[model samples]
Target chain A: MRRLLLAGPDFSLAAVDPHSTPGFDGGKKKGAAALADGGEVLSSLQEKLFAESRAGSEIAVLLVLQGMDTSGKGGIVRHVVGLVDPQGVQHHAFKAPSEEERRHSFLWRIRHQLPRPGMIGVFDRSHYEDVLIHRVRGLSPAEEIEKRYGAIRRFEAEVAASGTRVLKVMLHIGRDEQKARLAERLERKDKYWKYNPGDVDERGYWDQYQEAYQRAVERTSTPEAPWFVVPAERKWYARLAVQRLLTATLEDMQLSWPRATFDVEAEKQRLAAT
Target chain B: MRRLLLAGPDFSLAAVDPHSTPGFDGGKKKGAAALADGGEVLSSLQEKLFAESRAGSEIAVLLVLQGMDTSGKGGIVRHVVGLVDPQGVQHHAFKAPSEEERRHSFLWRIRHQLPRPGMIGVFDRSHYEDVLIHRVRGLSPAEEIEKRYGAIRRFEAEVAASGTRVLKVMLHIGRDEQKARLAERLERKDKYWKYNPGDVDERGYWDQYQEAYQRAVERTSTPEAPWFVVPAERKWYARLAVQRLLTATLEDMQLSWPRATFDVEAEKQRLAAT
Candidate 1:
């Protein structure tokens, strides 16, 4: 499933069916139950990863999630990452750049959010947002947007070389699906707080967003930090798939509970006397 | 207990008995039990603080722990902070300043670690370390050290006005307690890694360190962000007291779980239909 979902050079947004469940065979109830199971297992692995970090193993994992509004970035954070020990997880939900952040290169704020050793860092929206939003909204010049892609690639490469595994996922949702979700937000008084009227303004440029995301993915998906385009129309499948992606990546690291540095028997005896 | 531990104009280092439990009524087992209870309550409050931040409230808490080696800052982090949801807790252990950090004023690195709204930020050693160590070692001129006291007060005042509650703790341990703990570190082969040879050199300046800490506390313990002097010879007592200190400050915030701004029933319907 990881191999299939990994975005390659020719990774096309057109090929993915937003509603498809891919390798998962579960319905909603089954998918949710599976997510709970994955979360518990992931929780323990995350603890070992954290323990190993304190034990001085330099390895860590980072998950980057990006998508349009109502695509469930918040849900993913609340569910998948939420399952891990919060101590082991560092979450950054990138909002608009601050004046200080804007004064620097786009990567300045990106660097601040990188996970420390023994952490599972999640970027609710990441450096990719800079490129996607800038290009779709004509915020940055095309030359600058193009330049950012390489900069981001170089940055991720540098981080990967420093012992952080990066997993980038683009929650893929269809136009109709997004419309339904937005309409739901508008219709529901409680979700009104979650709704942004500006979201509708961006929906008008849906094609550009898809194009921007495709180009960004095509340019930045490298072996060290490849992008995953998860079909997200099925909220259950999207959540489950991300949970599975995280599990697979950590499992591949083969992190173990770190060995105690002190002598257990002698210390036990001495402490007993004390 | 909060009233007693909080330092004021006459906060005397000579007066605070390092072995005294002060306000606490319990022994080790009792202190341990209270800490567990406080931790459980604090965890819930921290979650609400975090949720309120996510819900758009601008309040946070910062707990700064400072003391000599073997003073149990690490234990407090492991035991007290370990009780809270790791996600809601942001812990920063400050070391020597880097080239960039040294370029700025002492408070520069401190600004970087202030808890975001809804975060319980614990600084294992903080900006106060600059004044404490620099003064005791004569690393900085006396005038510079004097200037820093005012600087810290101002910086903390600014954060307080911005809605961050600051609680500074000095874990006061006796000379005998320090000697015993350090000796224990050397005697246990496993604890060898924790033993630092430099600690012995610092022990030589014990009188100067006490004087420096006293001056710093007396000058900077404002009502908005007061310093607490916790007796540390009794490790369990110190831990429980600090935990209590934190819980009291948070409870004072009176932060409520924000009512849902959006219509719950309508969003539920929309989500259900989707």
Candidate 2:
């Protein structure tokens, strides 16, 4: 069975430098059409997976999407997983912690949003923010921050044991790409509002964040909940990779239509009378 | 603005029961081709509306779906509102109250799920159930139930005053139609799993529930939140009515795109360097 994992950096032309290697050219070279086809396949497979989840009443899937500022997280969710049955899907977009969320353990909000049976839950940004944001801002003591890595792994393992399959993805984009993307947003009158001045300060810590992500990935990518390094220079490629991973995961589950027990003739008669 | 409500008996088969007025024959009859066309139009309109909501960052829309067992609430949500951007849309399916929910006010759970600016929130079964279920089950006194009608009106008024537009729909089907649907479920092997003997007991209270629902609708259908009586015998027609109602509500909001503020020349330079 193929394990489900998909992660990438957001290097969209709207947010990244057009000349960046992982930009449009990377996407085109990676076979954009093939990626789109993969997306279509994923959409078809998701329907069956959803029905099976409802019928078999088995495992749940958790898709973790993480990226830097202006990463195409919103766009990917909009275009890719948008086709799935909303009733069978739950989306949790993590934002800056509220007063209540901050008062609890870091995992409290995530624990509350965990998908129920027969549901696929998508986390826009997840627990890793504890490391990512805290590390960057020096919010937590170094020792405590390091300790969280093990905590996350154990928490995820417990979730896996309880019938939830976790897949985490890290979007990798270069500084040049980020600058270009930010520039585009600044240039476009319509998109200017999305360009936050503070992002430049964050850009200064880009390399540091990348190293941190790489270390986090190496440490936390376990058998129970693996992390995929998605090459996201190309939006199309990233989208396709995520879709393929999701499709393979569902296919591995070997979902089948549950057997129906209704008598067709009786139903036909009922329909006729109705 | 025209209010879109979905009020129909659970299942009223027109072919079997010629006396069924809840069937789609009264409105524009939607055949397969028309259904497909309407779906396309609805999909496009919903997409546009979602974009407008995200860009304008002002108005929010709430879709309230009420129906009996197997009334196609899930199907309608999957097919109709499925086209909107997930970032700008949220789906909340209310279930039996949890221990915590039972401890709080009836409106507590619902109050928390209200859509933020620039989003559409869908309620599979909403607050009206307090009146519908509690009345039918005799969980509350007649005086308390009457008081709830006022509470509902006030709650809706508060929401609407806060710039949230509510579209309440009551899916109406006839008893014979419901029987046909239930029989179809029982006859099909795959669908048999969905049938419960308890549903029949609930079906027995159909007239009483209808009276309760009628009273609730009559009392709570204020200018802020009007209810529409939708003929749900035809799934296609029901979907169209919902789409039309949604589009009209969005149009009433007068949405527009947010202004951008990027520097084009500098962005081009940044892109060229990337």
Candidate 3:
């Protein structure tokens, strides 16, 4: 699933069908079952990673999620990242920059939120926003936006070098799916809190956002930190694919429990006396 | 369950059986089933609380877990706190104070990690540690330890007044149970990472620790912020009780989705055009 979804050198967002489920021959029922099974694996693997950290291992995992507003980023967090122990998971959702945040470089806040040793850090909407939104809305000048692409590449490269496995994912959803999601939010009183006038306004630049995402992926995709553009028209498939991606990455780390720091036999004898 | 577990006047730790499942009649099977059912309720209440926060509601909930070694404090974090959306949860596990942390009063670190509006904050061990372990180990002078109890009362009072509900729970496990759990950790290779020689040493002071907990509860339990001494020998019952306590507290908050900040019809029309 990781290889199939990777935004490789030949990858193009325009050619990838948002409705297609690549490399998986399963319907919703099968996908849901597989996801449930994956949860056990994910949980076990995360524990080992956390245990390893206690022994001074610097290794960690960072899952960076970039997607349009309604493309199931929150759902992935609830379902996939939620499968692990909350203690080992550091979940952060980035909104528009605050006044203090604006005073620093874009990566300043991102750096501060990076997962520490033995944690799985998740970014609901990450540094990719500076490039995606800033490009689409002209929040920064074109040259400044161009420079962010290289900056992001170097920043991610540094993160990858520091013992953190970086998995960058873009939940690719079609224009119509986003409209349907927005419509549902507006139509349901229970969901009204999620509906925003800004979301409706952003829809007018659908093409521009897509183009910006494509460019960001093309410029920043690297061997150490590749982006996976998962088709998210089917929510179940998107969730399953991301879950598999995360599980596979952790499994590749080959984590093991740290050796006992104390003498087991001696400790057992001491405990018996107590 | 909340009323039964409350540390009211005349409440004594010795009177409570660590193995008994008070206010709950069922054993593990029934307890597990009810816990699964409660997960749905917890998730729903958490979402409403999260939604209300978006509309500028200052309301929040804090769950503080204090327990002996191997009393399943981490289990409550996994089973009960894990039942909700991770995005809405803020979990912090307090360890021994660091150089910087020691420079401030005991409550300084606690105040720094307080849950913000529309979130559920959890502390594995909190300010009460000053009175519990400090009293047990003589980490501070006797008068200094006595002062923390009053400081804690005022600190929690301020937190409660700031629209955050405080649910303080001590997972009470018997000495025999702790010994059994520690022995098991020694018996399993995978559990070795959790075994500490110090845990067995702490066992020698079990009676003193109990007296300290009793005094701490008597001094600090109040109308606005109360402590609940949960019998954690039965792990299933402890998880279920904590889950229910959280759900009941959130339900009492009467959270609703924030009313739409924008004109729904107008937003729908604007959405349809794009």
Candidate 4:
């Protein structure tokens, strides 16, 4: 699974098939059960984190999700992170650069949305979008994109040092899968709002987007926060993979419930009297 | 029930008993069942607000919670808001003013945290504390505090005009109820993080705090955003009342799923081929 999902020093996106469910071999039925288990553990871990936060624990988890259009970013949010308490999760969906945002360095807005202590923050489409979309579309100069890669590495390292476990995932789906998903959206009257012509226009630059994504994964997959390329053609697999990644990342943090600070027995006596 | 929860023009803190559950005839079990029902409705309403947000509907909901320490503000967040998608809820817990915040007007930070279009914003301990605590503790001078009443009225009115419905709640509890809650916290080893010695010190000025809260409520309970005085001695009742109040506020918005915008028939053909 690590060999399949983790972007390595010599990683090549061309070597992996987007349709392949690399680590998960079970059928969709089994995948559903695994996801449920993952969801339960994830919820408990998140609760422990925020509970410890009450005692001033600065530990936090940040899930940075970056993917192509219709790669199930919203699905991951609703299916996985939705299981936890809203107070424990801070969800920030970064849209196009506002007029004021365009004036500042890219990381300025990203910095403001970084999860505070003990939060499980999901960045719907994060800093990586800048390098991916901007590079593919030439929103920024080539030199600036390169500089951003280096900046992202250093920024992520600093975040890790400050006690945030950064789990980055790229929902890798093939061109045909994207087409089917887009078409499905178009077909359903209720989903028409989600279907944008801009998405079709972007599909014309498919090769460029693929190249941009490959470069981003290779460049930013640091030891601190490596990118996971989950085969998202099967959304069940994608959601499950992301959930498992989060579960492992949080377990590694070794967060514990806060210890008591008051006189427990005497207080218990007082409460019992009441 | 309306008489119990709604603060009227002739409102007096002295007239209401903290231990009384005036409107609710239900025991804790019934209260729990009602809370579950309210939770289900609140979740659905919030989803509609966000789903329709794509079409540029700016309507949102903000629940401002105010109370003395250990007043179950945290419980409401955990129980009621916790049922909804984290993506749809934005919670801000206001603390003491930072040096930078102290430099600005008191409403500055409050304005920044107001829920964006299509989201439910929760203030755990909100700007009301400025009036409640500041007035009781003499954190600011008398004239400054008096000026704040007018400022808050103006600020909240402007927010209301901008498509947000404000539901302000004061968790009303007596001194003895607070003592028992504090004692319970002290008893539970796991709850020590929630216990603060300052809570006990603040309780020394319980009468003054009540007076300040009464004045704040009487001064700022405008027609746009009336204050709900929840008798919070019974945690279950407090939770159920809050959930119902939020349900009604959201229902009043009359939000619905957005209409389709694309050519449905043509899109259906395109999807069927894929």
lDDT string for model 1 (B238-269, tens) is 88988888888889999776665656566455
Residues B229-270 of candidate 2 have per-residue lDDT tens digits of 666776766666666777777767765435543455654554
Question: True contacts preserved, each candidate?
Answer: 0.04, 0.39, 0.74, 0.53
Q: Give fnat for candidate 1.
A: 0.04
**TM-score list, all predictions:** 0.69, 0.80, 0.99, 0.88
Pairs of colliding residues, candidate 1:
A86-B87, A87-B86, A189-B262, A189-B263, A190-B262, A190-B263
- Residue range A108-181, candidate 3, lDDT tens digits: 99999999999999999999999999999999999999999899999989998999999999999989999999
Q: Model 2: per-residue lDDT, tens digit, A1-274? A: 1222322233222333322333224446565576656655665556655655656666778888888876667666866777676776788889889999999989899999898766778899999999887887898888888998999999999998988888786655667767777877766655655665567768767767876776677677887888876656667666766766677666666766565444556545544454
TM-score of chain B of each: 0.97, 0.84, 0.99, 0.97
Assess candidate 4 and give its TM-score to the true structure. 0.88
lDDT of each: 0.84, 0.70, 0.93, 0.85
Candidate 2 chain B least-lDDT 10 residues: B11-20
The pairs that clash in candidate 3 are none
Off by over 4 Å in 1: A1-61, A70-91, A98-121, A135-155, A171-195, A200-220, A229-274, B8-60, B74-91, B99-105, B111-121, B141-151, B172-195, B203-215, B231-244, B256-274
* Model 2 chain A weakest 10-residue run by lDDT: A4-13
Candidate 3 docks with a DockQ of: 0.84
Tens digit per residue, CA lDDT, model 3, B13-70: 9999999999999889999999999999899999999999998899999999999999
Rank the models by TM-score, top first. 3, 4, 2, 1
Listed in order, the DockQ scores are 0.10, 0.31, 0.84, 0.38
Measured with C-alpha atoms, the lDDT of residue A207 in candidate 1 is: 92
